[model samples]
Structures are given as C-alpha cells and as structure tokens.
Target: MRPKPVKPKGGQESVWDYPRPPKLEEVTKTIEVYFNGVLLVRSARTYRVLETSHPPVYYIPQDDVAMEYLVPSDRTTYCEWKGRGRYFSVQVGDRMEQDAAWYYSDPIGRFGPIKNYLAFYAHKMDKCLVDGEVVTPQPGNFYGGWITKDVVGPFKGVEGSFGW
Candidate 1:
C-alpha cells in the first residue's frame, strides 16, 4: 500500500508532486561526493532526476568527477525511462566499493542530457552533499536517490514500498 504523501513546508518540496515520468533539471547547487576521505567529485553544474515517491538522484558530468577512481563494472541494469545503465566500482586508496556508481552511455528519450554523467550510491560513499548539506541515502540498496532537508517523502525503496 502507498503511504500518504507528506505536505511540504516552506522551502520544501513533496516527492508526491513529482511526475511519473521523471524529470531531469539542471542544478546550480554544489554537489559533492567523497569516499575514504577523498573528494570524488565536486561540481556546481549537475543534473537531478526527480520522480514521484523518490528523492532526487544527482548526476555529475564526467568532466567534474574523478574518473580514475571509477573502474567500470560488468553489471548493468535497466530503467524504463533512462535505458540501460552500466555500473562502476569505486576505489579510493585500498578501500573499494563495488558497483557503487552507474551511468547511461546513451540514454533514451529526453534523458540524453545525462549520457556519460554518473550518479553515485550515497550509502556507499563516505558522504554526499548538496549545497553543503549532508544527504541521507534513499532507503534500500537498489535506488540511488539522495535525501536532503528540502525534500519530503514517505519515499519508495523503504520496506513495504516495493509495490509503490
């Protein structure tokens, strides 16, 4: 069963208000990803994908990321809207996180802007920040959304949210 959507407060956005077909919008906020005490990426130019019942998933342009730390993995997954996604293993020093990032080399439909852009799994990283605010990873390991103070949700990927 779907949980009741939370009413957003001032300066907040309700995930319920997002669309079924996710929207990709350019974000000017500073997006940062860190792993093993190392900065993996930091950028003001990024895109965020917002969908109903989900927190925003921020994608950083390849140019802004530390590509050397991301080694391509053999795994792949499909998103109905975004097409096939290729995974990457993140390694910083001797520490490594497998399949910790993903990107679509050739996205479908309106998602072309995200091609070659990568989205990291916040839970696997030391920290992910948006505009300097630390983010909480979206519930469950399958989704890569990042939860922040400005977004409200009884979000998908939580227990009992599989059918949502």
Candidate 2:
C-alpha cells in the first residue's frame, strides 16, 4: 500500500520552491581572499549560489581556491537535511584553522539541501567580502552560516547541532 506523501510543515514553501544555488542565476563576478594582508585566493567567475535549506554558498572555481592552503580533513558528518559533508582546512602565514571549509559532493535525495556547495570558515577567513560588504561570517566549527552584522540567522546548519 502506498503511504501518504509528507507535506511541508506550517504550510510553508518547500525547498524546491526556489532554485538551488549551483542552478541559481549566475553573474560573472570577482571574488578574492586574503589572510593577514597576503593574497590567498583571487579570481573572477565567482558564483553566488544557494545551498537551499542551508544558505547561499559561494562556488568559486578550483582556480580561485589556494590549494596550497587547504588541507583535507577526515571529519565527516551527516545533515539528514543536507546529506554527508566533508571537511577541509585553510592555512595562512603560520596560522592554521582546522576544518574551515565543507562540501557535500553527493547529496542524498537532494531536493534543495547542499549538494555541491563549498563554504569557507568565516572565522578563519581574514577577509571575505561579497560585492564589497565585509561578510561577518558565521559561528561554530561545524556549521556554515554567513552571518554578517546585519544578516542574522538560525541558519539550517546549526539548527540541529545540539545533538552532535
């Protein structure tokens, strides 16, 4: 027998209501990264994409990320909302922050949760600005919420973290 389809809670719009980040409207823009005055990553073609239930994730081409500064970590976690996530680190001038970036390359039943979104550690990023606003960056070591001063959040990343 077929069960009833689950409906969106609170009569709210489901994640599918909006286009996913990678599939969102794209703009050929410039993105840059700096750590203690040293240019880490700077490039054009930076994309302002979405991660659905998560947040807007910036998808910079591989060329834009300083691979030299990124160290892969084995820390992995499941989102139930975004799928399994993998971690990475960034180093800058003798400073290293652990697990600063994360991505879910292959999400499960991806309706809108992060499928291929790459987010950096706002706290570790010495300087990260989007279209000229110095992004405030999100908090916590495992979540990826870009919470600038004005932009607030109870972002999906941290919604269920207390159990972890």
Most TM-score-accurate candidate: 1
Best model per lDDT: 1
Residue 85 miss distance in model 1 (angstroms): 0.2
lDDT of 2 by residue, 1-164 (tens): 22222245553333223344324435454556667666665656655444444345565555567778778899998866557888888777788878877777776653243444456766677887665567655444454545434332344444443532
Backbone clashes in each candidate structure, one number apiece? Answer: 0, 1
Q: Which stretches of candidate 1 lie over 4 Å from their true place?
A: none
Candidate 2: misplaced stretches above 4 Å? 1-27, 49-55, 107-117, 139-142, 147-164
lDDT of 1 by residue, 60-138 (tens): 9999999999998999999999999999999999999999999999899999999989999999999999999999999
Worst 10 residues of 1 by lDDT: 1-10
